[model samples]
Target: MTEYNTVLAPVLSAFWDQPNSWTLETYLKNGGYEGLKKAFAQKPEDLIQTIKDSGLRGRGGAGFPTGMKWGFLPPADGGPRYLVVNADESEPGTCKDIPLMMAAPQFLVEGVIITSYAIGSNHAFIYLRGEVVHVYRRLLRAVEEAYAAGYLGKNIQGTGFDLDVTVHAGAGAYICGEETALLDSLEGRRGQPRLKPPFPATAGLYARPTVVNNVESVASVPQIINRGADWFTSMGTERSSGNGLFSLSGHVTRPGQYEAPL
Candidate 1:
């Protein structure tokens, strides 16, 4: 048995017993918007720097730097840009985003807002796997709660930045997890991988500048913004810093999320 370090998840077990844990009221009481307050205090570029400093790498199969990805976009010039969250996490040995969405979905909402502000995008879309109906319902409920709580929708929390996030569940297909294939699925076509060289960051999803990232990658931003970069970079290896949730499955003593530094 070749064992590896399995890291724990943050919001997965954050609140077990509480009326409407997915509701805005519960998330607020549990120190949810505190990160937004901190995020709004800093300039957008500075927010990106904070994430870079945190050394928060992507949690999906790809360990790309979250901050650097956000910084790659050119300045908006009266054109539309989009943030596409790849919730279609169907890696053979992966199982994280669904549970996180089911347990504490507000963490994702916070991440979306902070990321939208940083990338100058007022609209975002989450492409979830269609096989899990329960998770889809839970995510829909979370979106409604965030909208009702003034964290989403027009003039967010008195800031001029406005964002609208939609949860899009894709038809069941494993190939859709590929960045270009997912984009094709999102655009209502057969799921197939498009040619690279023009990655999704450049021309993607209706021929606009789009950032397609994994669900866990999108959800990790709020904490990086709140804790500052130095605090985040303290863990992990030289190339891969920061703590992450690693899931060990099959015949294991305890098959759950465990936290470890790379």
Candidate 2:
């Protein structure tokens, strides 16, 4: 059997075992939200370029390059664009987001702030799987802590950028895992996938340009920003750089989450 230590690169899970690990203080002590600060220093377009250079990809099964996705959003029209996090971890073999949220939600919240700024969104939404009420509660508390720390509201960190994060519980429909269907469900409408031709990048939630990202995908932005793209690119393969959370379940000695470079 292979040693777990040799296979792991625990950036996202680095502080999961600390006492009161979810608190903003613990996060701050361990270098939390540093990415957002770095992100604020760059132009939104430049931020996107940095992520592009990092070679990070979506972990939500799509495996699409994240930077390219954000780049797809049209030039800002000064309207209400959004950064919707697809926290619906319903698909089989897809279980990293929930554990990440349960253990280190600050990563996601901070990532959301950075991503929203990069994509020119002042409003962001986390469409979480409703069944996991405990994780949902953790996320809410994390958001509140971020707000208290001046990371989510008006003039975050004195950067003059404002953002509001809303955590919405899904209706437990598997189809809602689809981006457009999730958007429809988010808008209080019947959950059904919307047609293409106007992709989410162009006409997403509220018919405005929106970027839908998975929890792990957004959770990665901070480390990339704080550590630099070259550092992120140093892990994983040439095509698929960075670490990923692999969920282990059933028939295993220690069934849980494992972070490995991919």
Cα lDDT, all candidates: 0.81, 0.93
- What local lDDT does model 2 show for residue 118? 91
Per residue, candidate 1 scores C-alpha lDDT tens digits across 132-247 of: 99999999989998898888999998998899999999998999888889899999999999988687777887888887777777777877677666766777777887766677
Give the root-mean-square deviation of each candidate in angstroms. 3.2, 1.3
For model 2, residues 34-81, the per-residue Cα lDDT tens digits are 888888889999999999999999988889999999999998777889
Top-TM-score structure, candidate number: 2
Judging by lDDT against the true structure, name the best candidate. Answer: 2
Clashing pairs in 2: none
- Summing lDDT over every window of 10 consecutive residues in candidate 1, give the lowest-scoring window: 4-13
Q: Provide the global lDDT of candidate 1 against the true structure.
A: 0.81
**Which runs of model 2 end up more than 4 angstroms from their true locations?**
none
lDDT for 155 (candidate 1):
96
